[model samples]
Structure formats: structure tokens, C-alpha cells
Target: MRTIEVFADVLCPFTHVGLRTLVDRRGRYGLTEPRLRIRAWPLELINDGPLDPHHIAAEIAALRGSVRPDLFAGFSVDAFPGTSMAAFALTAAADRTGDPALVEDVGMALRNAVFEEGLDIGRPEIVEPIAVRFGLEPLDVEATSAAVRADWEEGRTRGVIGSPHFFAEDGSGWFCPSLAISRDDVGNFVVAWKHGTEAFIDRVFG
Candidate 1:
């Protein structure tokens, strides 16, 4: 089994796009089974001052019409809360449960709440319902919040200063969302493990 550590900020449009792309291709990429893990590494989208949700939403809207634009176009960014706080919240969520999938779900839900449903994720009360929807216990909110703060500090120590960073099991990492890995470079390495491993390897590494 190989794990892909995805260091991303929920407030980042590129992270949203990259995640949607990965989710869309998960099965096609032969990562639909237990052999793959998607871990989150928190990153801050805004600094110094409060982020305007409306402006962020508009930027997300502009990203629509590009490849997979519909993945985020219909959302209203203005309805969501600030970016920095949301990132903190997600980190807290991941820490409380120790479930990477839950962390990813929380991140996705936060994005949807802010961009698609025009909800405020920065508010603990607002984010609680979404967390419940993912089967997380509402009481865990406090733990999740604390985790966010700790993760932020850890992220900085790791030199992760941006969103959509990829850390592969082989120690290969990518900081840019636009990075594309050639199969030949790590052909013998397992990209995914499933019934279609042979075919996936052939298509990617052949």
C-alpha cells in the first residue's frame, strides 16, 4: 500500500480543483481500494488580515469554464467564513478522529459549505452540522479545533508553505498543483493496487 499525503488548504481554488480531479479519477486510476490513502496537510490560504469570502468566491467562479470548472462554479464563496479559520477547523477535525478520510471529507464539506451552499465554515456552530453529516461526533469539535492549531505549526516546520502539495511514499513531493508525474519516472512503483493494476501500469508506465 502507498499513501499520498496531500498538503492542501481548503480555501485554495487549486486545491479544490486538484481534489475534484483526483476524486473523479480515483476509480480510473486504480485507487478505489484500501491500498491508497489520502492524507491532508493543512496550509493557510490567507494571512495578515481577514479574507473576504466574496472576493474568493468570485475567483472560484472565474475558474469555472476551465477543465472541470463546474466542480466549483455553482458555489457561493461569499457565504462562507474566512479562509484561515476554515483551514484551522479542518486540521482540528483531522486530529480528533485520526481518520484521513474523515479529514478529507471535512475539507470537502467545508469547501462546499462555503462555495456551493453559501454557508460559513469558520463558525464552529456552522461547521458542526457538516461534520455530523460525515458521521463525526459533534462533541469532537473542540479537539478538531485544537488539532488545527497544532497542524499549522507542524506544517510550517515541514517547509510546507503552500497548498496542493503532494508527498508520495517514496519521498517524492510536489508543491505545485500543476505538476504532472510521468509514469516512466516511477514505473516500477505502484501507483495504485487493485484489480486493474496491470492495466493501469501498462497505460501509465508502458
Candidate 2:
């Protein structure tokens, strides 16, 4: 199987939608050569601080009210993770198993716990069960952290524009392809389908 690497933050609302779209539409296109390799793009490391829950809550509100009413229905600001590094490391550990399905499944499960189940994935209590269910071994913390940092560095070299940046092994790339983000006149964020997005999705799964 070909690999399509996606560098994304686990807690990003946008990444949640982008990954969900990929999983939801993959079968529709009747193609599956490119298995998604979910990589880490921890915004906290890039920004040098934990993301503000209030800011994320605002984005979730806009996303839910605009184009994704069916998603994030259980989001809770209080349950938001304080840091995504550990979660990223968890996904990185999954990637190390050399199973694309496990990597993708673990990444999506982490996001689902956060966005739909109102779980604090930063906590072991929340993330551990998901790892165990996927048959993941105990994570090698040092190795996983290094893997995540390597992905961040690679994303920088590849010029990842933001979370959910997809890079095909063939060298084609797209950033946040699932939705178009814009601001309303009053400065509230609005989202819509990007023009020509379906063609790209076809290319991805086809």
C-alpha cells in the first residue's frame, strides 16, 4: 500500500473533520492504495504554549454551527486536553508498529475521545484503554517523543501549512483539504467546502 502522511494535532477540531472525511469517503471512491499515515504536528510545541480552551471552544462553535453540525456534538471545554504531546507520542508509537491501520485507528480514536466523548486525552486514564484496545504495547516514551519531534521537523522541512496537512508519497500535498475557512463580516469564522476538493479526494482514495 502507498502511504499518505498527514501531520496533524490530535486535539484540533479541523483535523478531526479532515480525518473523519477521509475515513468516511474512502470506500465511496472504491480505491484504497494510499493508506493514511497519521503523524504528529503538535501545535503546542510550534506555538510554545498550550492552546487556549476558550479559543478552541470558539472554533468548535463555528465549525459545529457552520458545516459540521453532526460532529463535535459532545465537545466540552473543561474536558479539553492540556497538552497534545503525550497523545502525539501515543500515535507515534502506533505508527512504529508498522501497521498503517493501527496508526490511523489510534489517531482517530484519540480525536474521537476528545471531540465526541468529552474525554481528556491528555490523561492516561482516557488514552490507555484506547491503546490497549488496539493491541498496542506499552509505549516507549523516549522513542515515541523522538518520533513525534522527527515528524514536526519533517513537517517544517516540507512546509506543512497547518494541522491536517497531507503529503502524498508522490510529492503532491494539500493543507486542510476538507473545508475552506474564512471569516464573516463580523470576524466570526465560517467554513465551507473548498472548490475542487472532491477531485482531490478522488485523487487521494483513487
Candidate 3:
């Protein structure tokens, strides 16, 4: 099985879209049971807390509708947390269980909570119940905190500078993949489906 590490922030919409595209189009890319590891690159930690993603209106508007048209007509992010530390901790704990499906399931749920439902995922109240539903034990805050940091530092070592970063089993990496953000002639936000995405998958599982 091929192993791939995907670094993303829980509150990042681009990460959500990129991940969704990869999962939804896995067969099109010929990926068969590729081991996907979700790593935390918590934006608040790296950028310091108190930064909301809705501040970047253009980028958000460009991708949100294109990624999931059924969700909404345009982008208007609701309230979210200042920090994603707590969310990252829970995700790290899920990863510690050494179950890829568990990590993906739990991680995606967390992402949905923040991006779609507009919940503050950085709250334990939000994560604990979900953890329980997955039959996972209470999180070891200290250990998980360290693990979260380690994931961030590892991403740094690999030059992962942003969310939605992908590292394939063959030692390849890309950031904000599966689509390209650009401006149309009218200067409106547009999402062009272009990237070296197929090559990334082929290099790993081919």
C-alpha cells in the first residue's frame, strides 16, 4: 500500500475542497487503498491565535462554490474559532490509534463542523462527543499536544508552508493541490481545475 501524508488546518476551506476532490475522485486517479495520514498544520498556531479565515474573502469565494456547489451559492463563512489547537489535538489522538480510516473519518467530521456548520472546533465540547462516537478514549492532552507540534515541525522540515499540502509515498509534496485559483477577465474569483495532481497520484501508487 502507498502511504501519503496530508497536512492541513481544520478551518481551511481549501484543505476541505482539496481533500474532498481527492477522495471523490480516487478511482479516476487510480489510487487503490492508499494509506493517507492526516497531519495538522494548525493555522492559528503557526500564525498565532486570533486570526479568522473569513478575512481572506477572495480565496474563500473562489473555491468554496466550485468545490461544493450543492452546499451554497457563494462564500460567506460563519463564525469560527481563533485557534485550531484543540481540534489538532483531537486529530493527533485519532492518528495515534494507527487507523487511517478512523483518522480520515474523525478528521473530516471535524473539518465539516468548522467549515460547513460554522462551529468552533477548537472546543473540547465539540470534539469529545465525536471522539466517543468513534469509540476512542479521552484524549491525552499533553501527549497529543506534543504530537501536534511534532506534526507541524515535521511539515516545516519538509517545507510545508500552507494547508492542503500533500506528501506522497515516493517523497513528493504539493500545496493547495487539485485546483488552481485565478482571476477571470472580469477580475472575479475563479477556480480552474488544473494542477500536477494526476502525476502526484501516479508517482505514489503507480
Ranking by lDDT: 2, 3, 1
Please give the lDDT score at residue 57 for candidate 2: 89
In terms of lDDT, the best-performing candidate is 2
For candidate 2, write residues 155-180 as lDDT tens digits.
Answer: 98999989989987788899998789
Clashing pairs in 3: none
Cα lDDT of model 1 by residue, 8-43, tens digit: 666666677666655656657667522223334444
RMSD of each: 8.8, 1.6, 3.1
Candidate 3 lDDT by residue in tens digits, 56-166: 456666765665664323333555666677777778878888888788878887777776666767687877777788887645678767887898899999999798898
Against the hidden true structure, what lDDT does model 2 obtain?
0.84
Clashing pairs in 2: none
Q: What is the lDDT of residue 129 in candidate 1?
A: 74
- Score candidate 2 by TM-score against the native: 0.93
Indicate the worst ten consecutive residues by lDDT in candidate 1.
188-197
lDDT of each: 0.54, 0.84, 0.73
